[model samples]
Target: MANVTVVDHPLVQHKLSIMRNRETSTGGFRRLLREISLLLGYEVTRDLELTTMRIETPIEPMDAPTLEGKKLVFASVLRAGNGLLEGLLDLVPAARVAHVGLYRDHDTLQAVEYFFKAPTDLHDRLVIVVDPMLATANSAIMAIDKLKERGATNLRFLCLLAAPEGIKRFTEAHPDVPVFTAAIDRQLNELGYIIPGLGDAGDRMYGTK
Candidate 1:
């Protein structure tokens, strides 16, 4: 089984609480999301490979460690994922970015992919797939499937909030990939939205609704 990390760090929880409040302004929401994404990115990158190198400090030469050869490729699951991507890019400015667009059908609640673009050497890079919500898990699973088809084997999924059902479904479908989330909500409603979740992350982030 894949490890599902619920990031209960006080900072994450505190930001999530603020995000859940409906009265939070659009500017505040966007700012908080970026901050939370940076925090989550830190945890998700904990195991990244590193190599030691000799470097000269202000006073003298010293051995320092830096990331290994493999560069990161960030795959954002469209609209909302872009918000998360901004903060992550601030941390890893050199990482390449790809976009995978998916929308849920209202009646079927299935993920329908409309656009996908990724690096040619996807298999050689560490890929981090980002989105704000993991509700039905349909979109995330499909996105991962497509990435694997494009030769991406090293991958991780990161999100701000996830539903329990979505987590179970995602892990069952892709046991090899680990997942990182700030919080896990109770369940998805009949409409496929997570219960008590901040409604429509995309709309919330963009102030479209």
Candidate 2:
């Protein structure tokens, strides 16, 4: 089974607490989301491959190590995912950006993809899929499925918060991909929202509601 890493960093926990409060102002919520996303991005890139090369420094010759292989592709799962993408890009400015949009049908609860754009050689790059919440796992699963269809084999999923049911479903569906989240909440409600989650991530991020 794929591993689901819940970041226990104090900074992540603190920002998440502020985001969860009902009284948190719109500005605060947005800022906190960006900050938390940056922190989570740090953890997600911990195992990035590195290679060493000899370099001549001002003082002396030295062997320096740098990242190896093709650059990463930060694939955002549409509107809500944009909230996480901004911070992640701050850390990996060289990474390519891709967008995939999926909407859940209110009646059928099925994931419907509306948009997708990715690098031509997706299989060679490390693809990190970002979204603010993992609720029912329908959208995340569908988004990843689309990536696989496009030849994306090296992939990871990042989220600010996740529900247990969503995590289970995601791991079961893609055991090869790992998941990183700031926190794991309880379960999804009937409406397919993570229980005690920060409401609708898209709505909160954009102050839509």
Each candidate structure's TM-score, on Cα atoms with residue i matched to residue i, is 0.97, 0.96
Root-mean-square deviation (CA) per prediction? 1.0, 1.2
Tens-digit lDDT track of model 1 for 112-160: 9999999899999999999999999999999999999999999999999
Best prediction by TM-score: 1
- TM-score, candidate number 1: 0.97
Name the Cα RMSD for model 1.
1.0
What's the lDDT for residue 151 in model 2? Answer: 97
Candidate 2 whole-model C-alpha lDDT, 0 to 1? 0.91
- Each prediction's whole-model lDDT (CA): 0.94, 0.91
Position 151, candidate 1: lDDT: 97
lDDT of 2 by residue, 39-115 (tens): 99989999999998999999999989999999999999998999899999888899999899988897877889999
